[model samples]
Target: MTVTWAGANARRLARQHLHPDAAATASPFAAPGDAVAAMLGAHAQVLSAAELSVGLRGDGLTRTDVRTALWTDRTLVKTFGPRGTVHLLPAADLPLWTGALSAVPTGPNPFPGNARMTPDQVEEVVAAVGDALTGAELTIDELSDEVVARTGPWAGDLVMPGFQAMWPRWRQVLHLAGHRGALAYAPNRGRKATYTNPGCTPLPGTGALPALIGRYLYAYGPATPAHFARWLAAPKRWAAEQFAAQAASGAIEEVAFGEAGPAWVVAGDTDVPDAPLRGVRLLPYFDAFAIASAPRERLFPGAAWERALGGGQAGNFPVLLVDGVVAGVWHQRRSGRRIAVTVEPLKPLSGARLRDLEEQVERVAAIMEGTAELTVGPVTVGPHA
Candidate 1:
């Protein structure tokens, strides 16, 4: 039997706890870790956006709550995740992420010979990084000094491009070290961010990918190997092989996904809701829903395809969702105790949707700890940095 996008969307929204009724009374998540685990990980390259991404899905969670979960309770760890980008993942799941990510073959190095490290050198740096951050936090510069001290002068060569400056060659393995559970973000020191070791051992790669794939399907099911490949930036052939091997072992199964054709879901998770999700949501840039949902054309139909997406990328601009589809673009600007919210709807909203939009704005402002003024007009700001 074929599954409709409606069914897929309903399952995904419910799994992510983004369904309309998920906000009523109590939260489904016991803590920020539960929320982070629900979506695999929350994009954290833009920390504030990541906070809103997790906060909106959780009940009555403030920005401070997310911060406390990360820096205080240590329930969440900021590290390099899928596609080698910064993400906030559940601390307990570090082993899974590190193991899965380390197993994926990295793409060809973009750096020149002088800047890139050999495989052995890469291992040395990862080990040195782990050793340096074992029980203390260090800023990037401090880590560089320690890495050079431990690994020798070649490790300190200034050849890697940074913020208009050259970083040390050892910096090339920073993400790898993160994926090896040797590095994670610590609380900011004055204005500089610091790194520390999570101190968790990573599972072997062979035993981790199967579990990780099951977790992925649970959060974004009715997917394809290509979808999984795209999500992790892994090679398509590798993803297909992994999925095929899993299917042969009865870990996953395939089903028709309406017009989108054959898609895979966890073997026993084929059921879907009778009705699709319906609600008005203001999703910040790189929100998991905007990024992880597949068959992009359906999620960002018509003009939304051109406006909501940036050359097929979903997270460059914050999106306004109606009934689980991208309906508009929105931007927020804060001034003292008030926030100015500008929304540009692709189509005129009905009265009910307009009311829902206002309510959503109120929720956003509350999470932001500010009063809000909404204007449904063109958003003049450019994409976030």
Candidate 2:
């Protein structure tokens, strides 16, 4: 069988790459792992608002299996650190994948225009926040207050200028702490900050970071270092570090990605290629398989990126990937009973493909809390360049 380049695209590869079990490559999440491994690998967490919203309206159904997956194998996690947003990533892949994300360096010289806190100040804030969050969960405000009290009123002012600048580091600290020790979001805080320690047992921590990159490679790989960097908001060097780590572990191999630059092949044994989009999938707005790869052009080529994600910021569109490559954009018309979907195509979707896409939409509507007729509107075709 000859591998063809014409059909080679991220979305196409992704549908071919995803696991049916949804269990990640990490061990605890894999079958037959100890409770400690499960806790250490992928401690399940409720999806953040964006995470829930992204997947809710599309390809996935939030069901009992979703919950069980959360427990037995690490299935859900707070996928965050890029553009300062949260996503729900698979649990087993959480640690190392997140590590790549959190590895952003905290430095003063870097990122001028209101530079970040001084090294001493950064160390102090991290230590103070870690201490405050160690025993139990605390809201950011609550956590900040504790840190301020420990230091003084001036402490908040001292950190005020650095707040947003340092948030990634701060978020990383909390997440890593939650992973290793026990500092999680407080229940008092809303779901965003509502974190708790899963107190059964913990794994002998494998360290949070390089692990994240490893997961991204295995799950969303054949991707470039830049792709990882872009996806995680990480420095190129950090991306390189992650790739290096995975390479050391024999977790990755090199592969061709056409014009998308270098891509690493996931080295772990995987089930043979099984393409599901052959079935038409109404993906949740940000189903990671679509959004996780970062650059829109590299992932969904053609003039689609701007037309889809480029109104305000780049790549902010809910895509419609028909038979792989982003064939168009889609949205939900939430009425009362049924959810209406309007698909705007970049190229005319043929009758058969259109039927396939509709079948995917029907599944999406069924995944909702209640049943309703799913009507895929007329395929509005055009080269919306």
TM-score of every candidate relative to the true structure: 0.97, 0.65
What lDDT does each candidate get?
0.90, 0.47
Model 1: worst 10 consecutive residues (lDDT sum): 21-30
- Steric clash count of candidate 2: 15
Compose the digit string of candidate 1's lDDT tens values, residues 87-198: 9999999998899999998877899877878889989999999999999999999999999999999999999899999889999899989999999999999999999999
Per-residue error (Å), model 1, residue 340: 1.2
lDDT tens readout by residue for model 2, 1-385: 2212333332324333222222232221122122212212221233322332332332343433343444444445442334345434445554444444444553234343343445575556556766665566566667767767765554555322344654333333344344332333333343445444433123323465545555565545556787777665557776687677777788776655555555676674232344343424444444445555534555467766666555423334456766555667776655665666677677777888777776656655554443434444443432221
Instruction: Determine which window of 10 residues in candidate 2 has minimal summed lDDT.
Output: 27-36
**How much lDDT does candidate 2 score?**
0.47
